[model samples]
Target: MPTSPSDTLQRFYTAFSQLDHATMAECYAPEAEFDDEAFSLRGRDQVAGMWRMLCSATRKSGAAHWKLEFRDLHADGLQGRAHWEAHYTFSATGRRVHNIIDAEFTFNEAGLILRHRDRFSFWRWSRQALGLPGLLLGWSPSLKRQVRSTAANNLRKFLALPPA
Candidate 1:
């Protein structure tokens, strides 16, 4: 039987809470797309790689600590939405972060996710992650673009690294 949207998301979140990128990747289709305040990614490889890069970085840092929570999940046919929160240390500045996000998803015919978009406040996030600078310019389009550029660059660098 095909997976229900709620079940697929539940599985995804379960893996996320454990920082299990492989399992998270399993929730997406080969051509899946993902986007958020930081950056956008297309194809399963890029999307999955993002999670792997993040989880691996945090784990290797030895200072990694985080939590994920999801609620208000709703699904209709191939679409789903959920309210989630992420609590973690911002790797760049070693700042504690509590990010609240709303996620929308679209599923492929095989019951795998084809698109995943997370919406959150860059201003709120910047204040926590970038501190003074974010407080002053978090709402600036330039600042937001810079953040997205940096994140994409970082992901590219991570993707370029050879397999362990």
Candidate 2:
């Protein structure tokens, strides 16, 4: 039987909480799209790779530095929404960050996520992740674009790597 949209979202976030990128990947349709403050991506491989990279970093930071909570889930038809929070050490700056995000999702007929978007405050995130520079330029469009570019490059490099 096909999964419900709510169940798919729940499984995705639950897998994320456990740092299980493989399970997270399973939640996406093969042509899925994802967007967030730092990155915008198309295709499940890219989206899943982003999750894998993040989960790997969180795992390396140790369990003490990583936490995830999700709630307020709602689904109607093929659409769903949820609120979540993530606490993790930013790998780039070794700074602690607590990010609150609201996510919207559209599901395919098979109940996999076809499109997922996460909204969060870039200014708040930058202040925590980038320290002084973030405090000064977090609200700037250029800074946001730069962050997206850097993240895309990082993901590209990661995708080029041979699988473990």
Candidate 3:
């Protein structure tokens, strides 16, 4: 009577598609970690908070749709990868942006996700979504360095927090 990693991943994806932060949080281990270009977060509370913020922002921005397509699922199901596309209108400018990202997830024996990592090109993302300003700013070497530093700092803070 043990849960499979694929089952856990499926549940996680279902929760994410529904924007069900609580259920999504439940799919992660208490001490799990998630990382992407923007930031890294540790623990269920921090991950839940990140999901809440993202969902709230998406809603506020009048997102039309968000979907994930699984590209590959390992046979053992210890790991998997997916492609995601999100359509939303910018709250400030009312411009529509389509964000595409590739994500990889890893699970532990308990069927809880231990790590989730996302890979994407910020420069291309900024240019396509935010236009010239984003293109110039995002591609700048200095800005990229700052972004990485900020993400590390955020991760450290999340790891330092007391468990909820």
Candidate 4:
């Protein structure tokens, strides 16, 4: 049986909390597009790759733990939204980061996520993730561009690595 949008979201969150990238990827359609403040991805491969990179980054950090919390999920027709947060320590800074995100999703007829966009305050995130530099320049557009560039570079590097 096909999953409903809410069911798909629940599965996505469950998979994510368990660092199950494969299951998380299955929540999306092949042509899915996902965008956040730092990374923008098109297609399932890129989106799934992002999750792999992030989940692995967290695991490798050792000093940080990742937690996922979500509530108020609602779906009607082909759209859905969720309020979620990722609580972890920023790898580089080792500072605690509580990223509050509002996710908007569009589902295909089969209820696969076709598009997922996450909105959050970059300045707020930067302050927690980058510390002093983030506090000083997190609000700058240039900072946002730099962060995006770094994210894209990280994604490329991750994609280039041989599968384990």
Q: What would the per-residue lDDT of candidate 2 be over residues 50-127, giving only the tens digit for each residue?
A: 999989878887558899999998889999999999999999889999999999999999889999999999999999
TM-scores for candidates 1 onward, in order: 0.95, 0.97, 0.75, 0.96
Tell me the TM-score of model 3: 0.75
Lowest lDDT 10-mer window, candidate 3? 66-75
* Candidate 4, superposed: residue stretches over 4 Å from native: 62-64
lDDT of candidate 3 over 16-100, digit per residue (tens): 7776767888888888888887667788767777776566556656646544444444426677666666566644356566667
Highest TM-score scorer: 2
Ranking by TM-score: 2, 4, 1, 3
What would the per-residue lDDT of candidate 1 be over residues 1-164, giving only the tens digit for each residue? 57888889999988988999999999999999999999799999999999998888667653356888888888789999999998888888888889999999999777799999999999999999899999999999999999999999999998999966
lDDT of 4 by residue, 17-97 (tens): 787888999999999999999998999999999998888878878324788888888889889998999898777678889
Pairs with steric clashes in candidate 4 = none
> TM-score of model 1 relative to the true fold?
0.95
lDDT of each: 0.90, 0.93, 0.69, 0.90
Where does candidate 2 stray beyond 4 Å? none
Which residue pairs overlap in candidate 3's backbone? none
lDDT of 1: 0.90
Candidate achieving the largest lDDT? 2
